[model samples]
Target: MEENNLIKKCQRGDKEAFQKLISQYHPIVHKFLVKITNHEQTAEDLTQETFLKIIRNIEKFDIEGKAKFSTYVITIAKNAYIDYLRREKRAMQNTPIPENLNIEDVHIQVEETVVNKLYGQSILENLEGLSEEQKIAIKLKYIEGLTLKEIGDQLNLETKTVKSRIHNGIVRLRKQLEKGDER
Candidate 1:
């Protein structure tokens, strides 16, 4: 099911829609909890607690907001784990919960990371028209983190030529992306 539709159905209090939404995000929430708690059983318990809180508070989530549903789930999962830590009194036997889980700074970092990844993917998809030389040069410099001299040496070209290829490739990419934005 489409995520927006699922969210809308969930907002309208459909039990089945909430189940589907949980199915979509359960693995991510579980994985994140596992990382924080370092135990499958604890992660599972926290995951359930997270969703229960979701059931109680899902109505307050703004479907039209910039935050993605996954981000919301993760933030809730973190909060659940934090609550677990506090309730169990940190001295709880061998619990691996990190001492430094900061809920205050979680949301912006997750949102920015998602945005950067999707933005980078869009740029990569628009690499169709670049020449083979330009593509290799750009990738070696940007993706592979090679200097111009190193890229030139690898490609058996002069450093100036490598730099020019990368520069022109970026200019063309920029123009194409800008034109795309107009539509």
Candidate 2:
């Protein structure tokens, strides 16, 4: 059956349709999660969670919507991963440091974490200054660790186009970052 028909069946509360839909999209979604999280087990958990949310919200998905179904699924997967990251960050914040750790060692670790956070924040801010096309390309390539071919497929662009965007974006970012450093 076509995707629209499958989605229609899913919307009508067809269990078999939902299962088929999951089977169809699970691999790409799982691969994306694995790339973004860099952890296979976490990717598996997030992939499962993403599909569960999809099952719950399938009725709301419009067959007439502009986004392709694949895009929709990827978006849901991204949001699920983001939510997981937030929960993990909160858990880290709430957890007490181990008593076995030396005070100076803990202090050094905390300092390193803070510096990393600041540098990461600056990169994110700079990313906002990029064109939407370049920003997406750069994030998928560097942050999510997706290959050029994967990014091209996801964005429906040529591999050459994706590579050019990433390279140019990085050059611009490097210039911007150097200016900031000099200040």
Candidate 3:
């Protein structure tokens, strides 16, 4: 059977069909994540995330559209990478710097200011690069943890449009992060 037909079957709650979809797309997902995070473990974990997300949201896949089902699944993988990076950066920051290092004594105020300024600048630049719809979708969905339907109601878009915007936003953010401007 054709892949799209398999996807349609999976969307309709066929468990075996879902497995076939996973088998076909898992490698593509892993490779996509490796391109973003450059870590084998991260890519493997993200591949699992992508498949799991697809399983959970298979009904949302537009098997009838020109957009391939694999594209939709990989988009989830890309968003997972962005979410991972943001979490990593926040974790790094929340770890307290050692007071005994005496680095704080020498340049405490200056270092803190520089770090904050750089971080702010990088985030602003990346946000500016995103489309208004993408930025809004990401902010609402990821930051606010709003459901897609809620986001749609708030933004006056279809739920699928909200998901697509969030997916596209994360893909663009992954590209930015891979460029190594980790501020």
Candidate 4:
């Protein structure tokens, strides 16, 4: 059976159907968690938690104009991961930095950690350099997950104009990334 149909069955309180649906989606959910968490065991635990929440809250889900099953599951997984990060950050903040740890080693680790973040920031800065309409259009269409038509509606632009903005923004962002790589 299709996942959507299986999800509908599960939502209707069929235990066997829910179990089957969970089994099908478990690997996908785990892989996504692993990518974000970078820990296999933690990913497995989070994946289980995600499915448990889904099963518990499935009744609240409306099929009408709702996001796809995978998108909904991913949003839940992303939220759970963000919550985990917040807790981890709080715990770390409560701990004192060890004075005995070599400053050079800490610096090296920080550099490695920040390079990717810097790359992303550079791309964002380039996007911000675009015309206001282009930047807003791209952000609505890509970051906000709006369709081209939706972006057009929100921006009071033609669909083609929205598409052009997104296309131009993506091209500029790519160029920025490329220039940074050359550096």
Q: Which predicted model would earn the best lDDT?
A: 2
lDDT of 4 by residue, 37-150 (tens): 557888888898888899999977776644667667776776676677668779989999787999899899879756855766665657646665566566556555778986
Estimate, for each residue in 1-183, the C-alpha lDDT of model 3 and write its tens digit: 498788788878999998877888877677656644546898899888778888898888776665555556656776776777678879999999776777656698777756775676555457657875687577667655779986676455688898999899899987885674544
lDDT of 1 by residue, 1-183 (tens): 278888788888999999888887898778666654657999999999989988888888887886667667766776676677667775666578677978766888777756764677557756646765676578668765779986665455689999999999999999987876675
Which residue segments of model 2 deviate by more than 4 Å? 103-139, 142-183
Q: What is the lDDT of residue 62 in candidate 2?
A: 84
For model 4 the local lDDT of residue 151 reads: 58
What TM-score does prediction 2 earn? 0.64
**What's the number of clashes in each of the models?**
0, 0, 0, 0
User: What's the TM-score of each model vs. the native?
Assistant: 0.48, 0.64, 0.53, 0.53
Residue-wise C-alpha lDDT for candidate 2, range 1-183, written one tens digit per residue: 399999999999999999899999999899888766667999999999999999999988888986678877887887787788679879989999787988899799878866875777667767757765687688889877789997877776789999999999888988887887776
Per-model root-mean-square deviation over C-alphas? 19.9, 6.5, 10.3, 8.1
User: Residue 182 CA error for candidate 4 (Å)?
Assistant: 17
Q: Give the Å shift of residue 37 in candidate 4.
A: 1.8
Predicted structure 3, TM vs. truth:
0.53
The Cα RMSD in angstroms, rounded to one decimal, for candidate 2 relative to the true structure is 6.5
Q: List where candidate 1 sits over 4 angstroms from the true fold.
A: 90-183
Off by over 4 Å in 4: 96-183
